[model samples]
Target: MTDSAEVPTSRPMDAWLDALSQPTGSPGGGAASGVMLGLAAALMGMVAGYTPDVPAVVAGTGRLDAVRAELLEAVETDGIVSARFGAALGLASDDPAREQRVREAAVEAARSVAELGRIGISLVAEARTLAADGNPHLAVDLAVATEALEAGLAGASLNLRANLRLARVHGASAAMRAGLDEEVGRLAAARTQVERIAAELSARLD
Candidate 1:
C-alpha cells in the first residue's frame, strides 16, 4: 500500500508531496486534491480491473476510465494548489502586518484541500455503490476497493484538517473557519455512511 503523503511527484501521490516539499514553485492544494480524487478513482479502477470481460465489468470499465481522466486533471490542479500554499506559508514572516495576508493565503489553501476532500469522499461513495452492484466473481476486488477508498478518504481528511488548523492559527476570518467546519462535518458524515455500506458489502462477500 502506497502512502499517499509520501508519494513522489514524479509518480503521482509522492510526486505531489515532493513538489510541495520543494523550494521550487510547483505543487499546490489543487494538485493535492486532484491526487486524492485520483486515488479514489484508482480504487474503482482496481475493482474493475479485477473483473474484466463480464458485461457488468465492462460497464464499470467505462466509469473507471472517466474517473481516471478526472483524477489526472485533479493531480495537475492539486499540484498547483500545493505549490501556491507552500509559497504562501513561506512568505509569512511573523510580522503583524503580514499575518493577515498569511491567514488569507492559508484559508484559500484550506478551502482547496476541503474541496478535494469532499470530492474524494464522494468518489468513495460512488465506488462503493458500483462495487456493490458489480460482478460477484470479483467481490474480493470490491473489498480491496473499499479499503483503498477508505485510505484515500482518511488521507484527504488529514490534509483538509491540517490546512484548516493552519488557517485558524494564522487568523483566518470567522466565516472562513465556519465554512471549513461545516464542510468537514459534512464530509465526515458522508464517510461514515460510505464506510457502513462498504462494511456490509465486505461482510456479505466474506
Candidate 2:
C-alpha cells in the first residue's frame, strides 16, 4: 500500500496540496483553485482506478486527463501566489495608513481564495456527474470520489470565508460584502449538493 504522506510531489497532482501546507510559500488562491481542481481530478482518478475498462473511461478520457493536468498546474501556481500574498501582508507597516493597506492586501487575498473555492464547486459537480454515469461496477469508487470532492469544496469555502472577513475588517465597502455574501450562499448550496450526491451514491452502493 502506498503511504499518502510518502507520495512524491514530482507527480503532477500530489505536489500542489503538499506545497500549500508547507511554511515557505504561496499556493494561496490560484494554487488553491488548482488544488481543488486537482482534488476533483484525483477523485476522478480513483473512479478510474476502480472502474477498469469501461466504455465511459474511453469516452471521457480527454476530459479527465485535461482536468488532471490543469489541477496539477493550478496547484503550483496557487502556491506561488499564496507565498507572494503572505509576503506582502507581512510587509505592511504599523502606521494607520499602512494598516489600511495591509487590510486591502488581505482582502485581495481573501477574494482570491474565494474564487478558487468557487471553481472547486464547479469541478466537483462535473466529477459527480461523470462518476454517476461512468461505471456501475465501480460505484463504490465513484462514491469515494464524491466524498473527496465535497471535502475539498468545504475546506476551500472555509478559507474563502476567513479571507472575506479580513476584507470586511479592512474597510471594504458594503457592496463588496454583499457580493461576498452571495458567493458564500453559493458555496453553501454547492456543499449541500455534494453532500446529497454522496449520500445518494452511498445508499445505492449499499
Q: For this target, which candidate reaches the highest TM-score against the unseen true structure? A: 2
Off by over 4 Å in 2: 1-21, 28-36, 45-61, 175-178
Model 1 regions more than 4 Å off: 1-36, 46-64, 92-97, 204-206
For each candidate, give its TM-score against the true structure: 0.70, 0.72
Q: Relative to the true structure, how large is the alpha-carbon lDDT of every model? A: 0.66, 0.65
True-vs-predicted CA distance for residue 152, candidate 2, Å: 1.2
RMSD of 2: 4.7
Each prediction's number of clashing residue pairs: 25, 8
lDDT of the structure predicted as candidate 2:
0.65
| Tens digits of lDDT, candidate 2, 67-137 | 67755654554555566557656764665565566566656665665666655666555666565666677
